[model samples]
Target: MTFRIAILGASGYTGAELVRLIATHPQMEIAALSADRKAGMEMAAVFPFLRHLDLPKLVKIDEVDFSRIDLCFCALPHATSQEVIAKLPRDLKIVDLSADFRLRDPAEYQKWYGQPHAAVELQKEAVYGLTEFYRDEIRKGRLIAGTGCNAATGQYALRPLIAAGVIDLDDIVIDLKAGVSGAGRSLKENLLHAELSGGTHSYSAGGKHRHLGEFDQEFSKLAGREVRVQFTPHLLPMNRGILATVYVKGDPAAVHRALEAAYAQETFLQVLPFGALPSTRDVAGSNYCHIGVTGDRIPGRAVVIAVLDNLTKGSSGQALQNANLTLGIEETTGLMLAPLFP
Candidate 1:
């Protein structure tokens, strides 16, 4: 049975990506699309690349008949998605691409997002949507919350190592560089071409990033204790991708073995041969994440780098991956597009 789906916030980068991937998806159909600000406009006019697909005109969320949608991709902004999704029919499956439901604890959500969760009951039921690690839970969940793009990158490098006890628990350090699109489609002074070009600066430095909460939650759960890693994100001038270089105290060979074993059967995640690292350009525009591991110059330590398109694998693609599981569809359908290289 083909599933009927809706893209709730169709004008954003993540929403456009969902349309691109789902347009050709064999088991899903786009039944409704909403762009509150761009209601009544053709999706093609808002995103020219999507012009070729035959899709519904944009509508406001309230105007759509959600009862007909088998699944919905909530690509709305952080706090906004929570309010909108809370009122959605409970039986409708949802994959939320926002910060609202990522953190499981209600208190932590408020601490990081500066507001109480509007729908605590739904928040309690939401599954963390890291497809490779949480596939079992996702397959049975009604609500799935996508991870932070930065958090996803960091976890890709560290989660397996932590689970296997291959890395020193206290010394983990994550330095991430993300392209401008990871900041979203919002307008900001710093994202302007003249300002962002030729220079990169760290924002939310000194462990101030909200994604760290995710790192702490996931890592601590793995090690069965509190684990905090230093994470600082830099905004690069490019349009899409994330490169997270992680430093850990572990045997390099063990690091490679651990990641390889964890992802051997996974379709979207690729572990590069040892000593050969991946570039953001290698994964741009695709759902694939390329990870490489090597011994650091310092003995007893290893450096692992992971690359992915922050907009795709890091956000919307991950969203769809979880949606596939929730709806009992193949995980990699319409997600097989190769990375673009120059």
Candidate 2:
């Protein structure tokens, strides 16, 4: 019951991550690997770190023969993935790591993304790929849209609380700090070693961040009302994790209990002891999210902090987890690697 996979944008961090994990999969193999600019080049040329493994040479997406791919991980840029995936085989199973199909509403998609979906027909068929909550749906979906790394971290820490009626929806606030790799392998003046290595600053503040759309959509659905949370994300000087600290009005004890109860059975999600907070270093380079809960002096308020490697658990790890489910394979397959510690 081996599943053959193709990575449509295999040169980026997330794409390479999928390759790294899938290489060790007992039941999955790389059937195709695409990177337009890196086409005809060995993966080692693009990412020297990944040179150890013997993998298919990178090819252009247009050259991929879908007939040979059982599943495709669409790691292409947003807006771009929509058109690429639309042109793909209608029957090919897909896990998109772009914002293209994450929002079910085309209107919402257009509003935040500033363009109409290129594949509204297929968008309607894509399921949100949040591993813990959407496991059942993912198992049956022909196409699954992976969530934003930041969105995934926040949701993991709070969705269960919202579902269990244990938090104040209107009072929620989220502040996230993420490593530069989450921005992708592209070169940006701001991301250069000179500028980004010495300091951290917030961008997309005052509710300007696009991922808030996903948080709003998911939280509102679970709470049965329109809910908005003030979210701000900052870029850190380092290179591989996301830490989201969420504050909400709720009994801290209940917050802790709710999260514990929700994730008690999950192998990749870890809820820490009460009053403890998690650090990005703790879960770096692993498909594990360490969440901590604390009680506030106000008694009815609490703070929750979550951490995970943005490129791993936040993206590729989640993709691999959903792929495992979709292929009817063990959900934890090829994803049991321990976190890379300091």
TM-score of each: 0.98, 0.98
Q: How would you encode candidate 1's per-residue C-alpha lDDT over 225-291 as one tens digit per residue?
A: 9999988899888999999999999999999999999899988889999999999999988999999
lDDT of 2 by residue, 171-247 (tens): 89999999999888877899989998889999999988889889989999988999999999999999899999999
For residue 83, what is the lDDT in candidate 1?
90
lDDT (CA) for every model shown? 0.92, 0.92
**What's the residue-level lDDT of 10 in candidate 2?**
96
What is candidate 2's TM-score against the reference? 0.98
RMSD, one per candidate, in order: 0.9, 0.9
